[model samples]
Target: MNMNVAERQGDCHSQLLSSHNARDLLNSVDAFLFDCDGVIWKGDTLIDGVSQTLDMLRSKGKKLVFVTNNSTKSRRQYAKKFQSLGISVSEDEIFCSSFAAAMFLKVNNFPREKKVYVIGEEGILEELQLAGFTGLGGPEDGKKTVQLKPNCLFEHDKTVGAVVVGLDQYINYYKLQYGTLCIRENLGCLFIATNQDAVGHMTDLQEWPGAGCMVAAICGSTQKEPIVVGKPSTFLMDFLQQKFQISCSKMCMVGDRLDTDVLFGKNAGCKTLLVFSGVTSHSTLHDPSNSIEPDYCTNKLSDILELLGP
Candidate 1:
């Protein structure tokens, strides 16, 4: 633990969830919320002892809920990945930005006549389709491009009323051109993004541009910000509370990012545990400029087992 963090929240901040008061903290929370990409696994590899820690927690009758800002995979797909990784998670145990995006449109009473122009992946498209929304401009278009010649014209679907952006690995100038035109040309057009994370760690040492990068491009051109539905929004937290009938006070959010995960937990009135296995480093947390802080901090997910006992 850093001296600065200790001073801000004191040495007894949430009891540190250490061996001294781990039992009390564990007993207090009925459920544990997790952020997937950083906390559990890094890319296709599972972090050491993550499965064991989760299993141990589950054995104690604690409910596990995964809240992720990743809009690339739908809940079903996420479940499949969990099975492959030996995590034993169900579809209901997962909530993602893709599902949140679909729910947002549904709750807003989006017209059936209007379709969504997707700047994302198959997961987002599947969610939209399941939500009874027709989506356009996905990987189905392949690498198609339109020439901006003097006498050339670009054709767009007139019925696309909402432009939904997510983590699209196949992002291109053509997609950006079309997405920009849709928001600029259409009246009452809705622009939305799954998250605004600038960069996502592809691996322990490699980083890739996230959805926010592409969303920023569109925003720059259209001068319109999107209605984000991912972490730190509190919409998903509200959705989970309503869906699972769980109280915010009885939950703890564990993640590796301070801005999204810690801030989300803070906004939702839940205890937050920060792990130093991903984006944030100890020095980063120690920085005075950093505003977001978690109730407890540890080296990794497995460290929680110290409180669980042998």
Candidate 2:
């Protein structure tokens, strides 16, 4: 998931910034957090200026962290994709909702004996696996989603540890109720969420509530707070700051979404760069309903390179 920062283009100077200006900002940053979907790639195609911006930043000795609200793929998967796009990145430089979740699990003593009862796609499953944990699927009681079904968490696997919540295209009332009950029983099995995005239904106007909805169900039902492993949370920023040794002040968060990316940067007290390559557009900037604002806005990532003053 990415945050939207509505665009209001600045008047960039006609002349490119000197090496000093470029390095000045580079020197000011301690870390850099970027959203992957709109700012970097849309589908399998990489956006313009992404490679050059990254290269320029890298050449300036800036530390970069690719932050995405997407929890569907593992770090390895992301790294491979970036490599395929001819962009150089390491798994260490990537952080997703799943990464935050794995860190939370390890910090809390999960998978030692607790198994996750997953309610999301395979991405969360892979994340749990890398964290030295195993999970089970909900009971196949001949239940079909997008319609009707009975509660299933009661049918939790004997080795179930926590109820893992991810993205589910075919969610139904039964899944929600069952998941709520699982947390209620105090199996001590926790509720872990990959990412709590409101844009789960981007492909469809229905705007289906994502795992965050399920998380709300569990929290409402059991009054138990599940750890959120995504942007807008300080964990991802902390991870970047710690891993990259970038000073928080010199860092910037860049993304197309305002809620996830820009808000996330604001929370971390870092500079924010909003791009309109995807998801969000300039119209959103003037809309009061959109309760977010970024420090900078650009039509494309390339504009950032364009704005570097001498």
Taken over the whole model, the C-alpha lDDT of each candidate is: 0.86, 0.70
Most accurate candidate by lDDT: 1
How well does candidate 2 match the true structure in TM-score terms? 0.78
In the range 186-291, model 1's lDDT, one tens digit per residue, is 8889999998888777565666888888789889999999999998889898788887888998999999888899999999999888988888887677666677
Worst 10 residues of 2 by lDDT: 8-17
TM-score of each: 0.94, 0.78
What's the lDDT for residue 185 in model 2?
63
Error of 1 at 172 (Å): 0.6
